[model samples]
Target: MPSSSVPSSPSWHTRVELPSDVPAVHELTVAAFGRPTEAELLGRLRTDAGWIDALSVVVTLATDTGSPVGHVVLTRAFIDDVPALAMGPVSVHPDHQRSGAGSAAVRASLDAARAMGERYVFLLGHPSYYPRFGFGRASAHGVTLTVDAPDEAWMALSLTPAEHPLPSGTARWAAAFAMP
Candidate 1:
């Protein structure tokens, strides 16, 4: 899979896991971002009392010796008061760039969201990277952001068009994400 490659060495395995792996997930995020801001954000989100456990996905090495190399988190957000999922802060360790670890993490998170019956997901990220996951410009669906951001950077994905469909309104992230 494109999401499980090892860019330089071509010798790592990426697999998804449960919340018990938070510490390793944090380490991977720190290593990937070279800072604690993203990690802190994730920490705050996890304890916010509103986090949806089933939507959090972590990608780790298949072997016991392999440490977590990438992380992706999806949490409850809103579109004009309509419940939705927000994808963000996806991280792949510097050494693992182009290895597909980040892609795998995203794919896993999306799958989890679908299974949990979530219909819409929003993200403010690279205009390029997220399209492969069926994400498109949120503006196309009437979705907007409260804070200033590039229009192309804000995207959304709908898992069930028949039911909830896409929402049109301002995106509202959790309070933890709202903190500076």
Candidate 2:
């Protein structure tokens, strides 16, 4: 069964992805990125040591028989040896793009991570979009990535900022990410 629903728009609700959601999530991810890369990454992550079953989240339409319309995952990563999370492969079905499903899923996943006592999250994503979730440039706080990405695209969020400050070190992603 899906986990508890998170705050969402009236049209949809967010919850942890059930095992049965695999196929739909793959399709939604491919649709969102217009490529198989991220979808393939999702599959690899699922089998990798980084997979966190409870952190895979989905957004289901309230009026559409509850099929998932969006998804996001927070998986194990590290800053030096300090454990953290890597958020990625966020996806919303093409039809649901720009309709808030993506944001809802991401927010819910972050909330779930916080509830699980996770302290920090890092991602390589749209600087403009992630800042809305309290993400700031990772490099600004001394976090670096082995992968070569635009500086502004690398971001981090300290979920418990007052209690746990962001650590300074190179991000070490899951092996599936192929980050050097």
Candidate 3:
């Protein structure tokens, strides 16, 4: 894990989350967040139809290892009947928090979304932390979620600026999100 002032590709490098990485990823997720909540949500996402392979990305200290030092998951969600992505629970082991691994995984996740023809990604996270990856307030882009959150904390990124613009509507996260 490497840390830089601005998020970079990370010296550790990133890869698509594989079945083999699940256990380590779960452990890391729990350790990073100090709770089983995120890991449980990931499990729910995995068994749900919203789990897109490309959306689950990870970063590791070495390519040969199945253990992920960090992870970022994006899942199928809908915005006004158009398909979109919901990003969250981006986790980095507590030991690697400041290391660039988390940022690297996030970058990889966004890149994968664009490559998959996804147009929009929404997230509820730190207002100050996510902008480096080009995220801005979701409301500003006309994207809304079905829950309450601070304006700045709910953010979005438009993958296809010219062809796909995020719309103003409720974002229905996957079943795993369990948003009431």
Candidate 4:
């Protein structure tokens, strides 16, 4: 049931990760990145205060297999002391990469954040792939990360732009992501 096949506009059901999801998420993170770096990072992040229960979302399926096919995380980060979010380690099982699973998980996480009145979300990820969710160059808004990232790869999205503009300055991610 771990097939990559999904509907054209998949009716993906997403929910917060349960304790049981840890193993599958770790697996998907490793499979998606082809490494354990992000998986280790995720484990550390989970124990940190930045971790928000509602923001660790997974894409649930109708199949009897009942394992999540995708996962995305939104941890508390900051912009010059102002609260924001940092999304990352987003991954869809390689078997489901292009099947809309990733997008569904991300959208669900973002929607959950918005419902919580979160305003700004930032991430260091693919420039081309994230924009569809309303992300744009963080540097364009004068935002930067602690480490050097290509201008275009570091991006932010405003879930409540009219109210809270992404405060400009260094984006302070959770301590787990501190420069090595």
lDDT of the structure predicted as candidate 3: 0.86
For each candidate, give its TM-score against the true structure. Answer: 0.85, 0.93, 0.90, 0.92
Better of 2 and 4 by lDDT: 2
Cα lDDT, model 1, residue 159? 84
Ranking by TM-score: 2, 4, 3, 1
Residue-wise C-alpha lDDT for candidate 2, range 34-111, written one tens digit per residue? 999999999999999999999999998877745898999999999999999999989998888888888889999999
Ranking by lDDT: 2, 4, 3, 1
Candidate 2 residue pairs in backbone clash: none
Candidate 1 C-alpha lDDT tens digits along 1-180: 468865553444444446567888888789888899999998998887558877676666555434677878888888888989888779887877777778878888888888878889999899988999999999999998888889999899898877766979988888889822
* Candidate 3 to native Cα RMSD, angstroms: 4.5
TM-score of candidate 3 versus the correct structure, residues matched by position:
0.90
| C-alpha lDDT of residue 14 in model 3 | 85
Q: Which candidate comes out best when scored by TM-score? A: 2
lDDT of 1: 0.80
lDDT of 3 by residue, 33-151 (tens): 99999999988989988998878998987654566899999999888798888897899999889878888889889998988888888889999999999889989867777788999
Candidate 1 minimal-lDDT segment of 10 residues: 8-17
lDDT of each: 0.80, 0.92, 0.86, 0.89
Q: Which residue segments of model 3 deviate by more than 4 Å?
A: 1-10
At residue 174, candidate 4 shows an lDDT of: 87
Candidate 2 residue 6 C-alpha distance from true site, Å: 25
